[model samples]
Target: MRDPNPSETASPFGPVISAYSRADAIADGVLVPVPESIAKEAGFRFPVALTSAAWADCVKWTDADSEAQPTPQDETGRLWDVLYVTAHAMKKAPGDREFEVRLYRVPRDGSTGHAKPARLKSVIGPGDDLSPVITIMCPDES
Candidate 1:
């Protein structure tokens, strides 16, 4: 029997191309998976992850970073700030699946400064299994 979907059969345009999946992104380190417990504590109902860029920018704190800055920072605290702000932003627009949140996090670079305001884009979209999942990334990211 012929399939109703054009892509199911031979495509008139060209051969079908395989696309990268969310699992592939996670495995490739492009997406960093957040602990389910932490996510739930932040009011997330589905699995949540952060883009590599976002993770590096907001959550990657180290001993060197602490010594460089006047105030100390930790990965756990930074991660919580990101997730908590994101959850609050989601609540502000419950009907929207995609939104942007502004958050403050100290830069990990060897620069002595206060927390810088940054924008993160949040998307509640399908995962590799077609289940609802949330991915937090920089505004410039996909």
Candidate 2:
């Protein structure tokens, strides 16, 4: 539920997704905060659908000149500071028509880097509903 944007005027790829602590989700039935270890882990997947395409917006570096592009070394301690997806997907179940959702976390802070924000071509449209399948986490500041 927290907006990880660096500034209001900055162009964002999509709404920054928040993480909830596992404890809060079970105790209060709320999902807004993320666990401290999430950043260090490779990634986590939930059985939730990204009903809206807004959740899949992302930043991409389009410049062809490799020398001009920002390197990974420039992003130390700053990648996840903002947050963006490394990978994401939506798939229909094998037997039933129900869809499943997966969002992979990018290692760096994609929200404020030199990349331009771009919409994910693979994102699900407005017709989908992920609230039932996914478990939302607690807010970062909470």
Candidate 3:
């Protein structure tokens, strides 16, 4: 994953190139990397779970809001940089869960739960400005 905090602290989230126990270990597991198109289309984030109460720790596959406040905006009129986080629940049948994309604003602190970090702003999809779920992210942002 690129530095999770790329704004200033260096992206904590990026390509994770590592070695596993064995080739079968990789084969036996179902770890699917986010496709390049999905990353580009969404801006800069990958699939994640924000439900974790503690963002610093990857407790579960859930996204969460770490800081109690929203991330401060920069020079641009924008409040945050675009970064989509697709969330999916594993299926019993297994292959992979049908993922759902949610925009997230990854603040400079390497936390996806920040109030402002370009994340999903629409419940429908990206570039979708017409909807009740303008802040498709955590209810707090809305």
Candidate with maximal lDDT = 1
* Candidate 1 steric clashes: 0
Q: Assess each prediction's global lDDT (C-alpha) against the native.
A: 0.91, 0.32, 0.31
Please provide, for model 3 over 1-142, each residue's C-alpha lDDT reduced to its tens digit, 9 standing for 90 to 100. Answer: 7787566774467555764432232255322222345444654343321221212221112222323324433411122122223323222223432333333433444433454433232232222222211112333322
Global Cα RMSD, each model: 2.4, 19.2, 19.4
Name the runs in model 3 displaced over 4 angstroms: 1-26, 45-142
Candidate 1 local lDDT, 22-97, one digit each (tens): 9899999999999999998888899999999999999988888889888798999999999999999999989899
Report the Cα lDDT for residue 90, model 1: 93
Please give, for residues 1-142, the per-residue lDDT of candidate 2 as tens digits: 6668658856576665875544444455332323435533524343322211122222222223223434432332222322334222223333232232234323234333254433222221222233222322212111
Instruction: lDDT for model 1, please.
Output: 0.91
TM-score computed on alpha carbons, candidate 2: 0.18
Ranking by lDDT: 1, 2, 3
